[model samples]
Target: MDVNKTYKGVALQEVLTLLQQHENTSKVIAGGTDLIIQLRECKVTPQVLIDVSSLEEIKGIEIIENRVSIGAATTFTQLVNSPFLNNGLEGLKEAAKSVGSPQIRNIATVGGNICNASPAADIIPPLLVLDSELYISDINKSRTISLEKFLIDKGQVDLKTNELLCHIQFNNIKNNQGLGFSKLGLRKSLAIARISVAVWVEVEENTYKQVRIATGACSKLGVREREVEALLLGKPVEEKTMQLGAEALKTQLEKRLAGRKGMEYKREAIQGVFKEALTKATYLSKT
Candidate 1:
C-alpha cells in the first residue's frame, strides 16, 4: 500500500501532466466522497493521486448560448442554489440536494457521482431524463458521450483510465416543460436509492410533445424508457393515458432486469413513482 504523497496543483495542465505520467493506474482525488471509501476498502489502491480540488479549470456552471455546461469539480450545493435551474431544471437541482446529506452535498461533485458509475447513483437518472452529455478528456484525446453511453455497465464506462471526466452539458428547457424526480431509498435522508425515477415533459395545449422518463438503481444502468415515451407522445395526459404510460414503463423495466431478486417490490414501486411524476407534471403544466 503505497500512498505516493498528496500532490496539489493550481492549474489544469499541471494536474493533467501528473495524472498522465503515472501510467493508467492513478486516480484523481476530487471531492473524495466515493474514492476515499473505495481506496480504504482495498478495492482500489493507486500509487499516484493527482488532486484536482484546487484546479480552476473544472469548476462552476455556465450558460453558453443555449447550452448549460456544468464543471466537473462543481459541488452539489452549487447546483442546488443555481438561479437558472431553480425553476427550469428543478428535478436535477432536487436530486443534487437529495444526494447523500448536507455535508456530502457540500463537498460531493457531479463528476464524482458519475465517475462512481453505480446503477443507483442518485444523480444519473435526472441527467438521463435531461439528455445531458458527458465530456471526457485525456491528455492525448478528448470525446463527448451521451449520458446513455457514458455508463456502459454496472461499474464500467467508456471512460478510459487515462481520461478524466470533464463535465456534463445539456440544453435549457422551455417554459412549457414540467419536471419531476422521485427516489426509493431505504430512508429519507443520506440513503442510496434502491430505485430512482426522473420525468420531464413538455405540454403543448393538452397534448404531450417531448417526454423523457428515466429509471435507475433497478436496471443494470440508468436509461430512458422509450416505450413509455412513445405512448405518452402526442397523447393527452388523462386518467387512461397516465395509467397506460405507467404500465408501459413498468413493462420496460421488467424486461431489462428480468430475474432481479427485488423485481416484486421494485416493479410495483417504480410504476407508482412514474405515475405520480406524470400526474404532477400534468398538474403543473395546467397551472
Candidate 2:
C-alpha cells in the first residue's frame, strides 16, 4: 500500500533488470493474492513491486521432450484445467482445486505459492512428490535448483535478492507411476491444511518399485518423508505395508514435533491421510 513504485512487468528480462536495480528493496509479485494481504497487514513494506502476472515467459504449461515445465505465473485455475496434467498427476489438480476459492485460484500463481513458502501451502506437497525443480534467473545469469533444496525454512528460500523464479520443471509421470494427495483442514474450503500428504509410487503387480512421500503443515516446510518412503519402497503393496509406513511416519513426527501440542493429533491423523493418498496413487498406477 505504501510502495515507492510498482511496475506492471511485461517481460522476464525487464523484471530482472528492475530487480537488479532495486536489489533487496524490490519484491516480485505475481497475482498479488498473498502479497497484497501482506502489504495491507504491513507484514512486508517493499520500496518497489515488480508485477510479473502478465509476463508471457512465466504464464503457461508446456512439455519439452520428457520434461514438463510449468510457468511460475500459471494460476491454480490453469493447473486445475490443464490437459497435460491428467491421469497420474491428479494429485496436483486436487491440490490446486483445494486452494482458496474460485476467485483466489483465478489470480493466485503457482510461482507465488512457491515463492511465498507458507508452511501450509496446498500446492507444494504434490510438487515435492514429483521431484520438481526450479528455474531461477537474474540480470546476469540463470540457474536451476531442486525444489527440495530451494526451500530453506518457513518463509525462506534460496532465492537471491535480485533473482526471479521463472518456472517449475519435472519429469513426465510414467504409466507405472502415480501421484495422489489428501489433506485435513478445519473446513472443506477456505481452510489452511492442518495436515496434507502426497504419495508418489511406482508399482508392478503387488510390489512397490519406488515410493516418495511428502507432507505439508507437518514441519517448518513442506518436506519429503524419506524414512517413510524408504519403508514402503521395495515392499509389498498391501495393508500391512501401508500400516508400517504410517507407523514410521508417526514415529518420525513424534521426534520432529516432540514438544508441540499438535504432535499427538498429527501423528494419528497422518495414518488416514497417508492411506487415502496412497490408495489413490495405487489405483492410478494400475490404470
Q: List the residue pairs that clash in candidate 1.
A: none
Write candidate 1's Cα lDDT for 51-146 as tens digits.
Answer: 777767788888888888898888899889877673757778878888998999988888888888898888898888879999888777778999
Model 2 alpha-carbon miss at residue 230, Å:
0.8
lDDT of 2 by residue, 196-241 (tens): 9999999998799989999999999999999888888889989999
Query: What TM-score do all the candidates reach, one by one?
Result: 0.94, 0.98
The whole-model lDDT of each prediction reads: 0.81, 0.93
Q: What is the C-alpha RMSD of each candidate to the true structure, in Å?
A: 1.6, 1.0
For candidate 1, the 10 contiguous residues with the lowest summed lDDT are 278-287
Which residue ranges in model 1 land beyond 4 Å of their true spot?
A: 283-287
RMSD of 2: 1.0
Over 4 Å off, model 2 = none
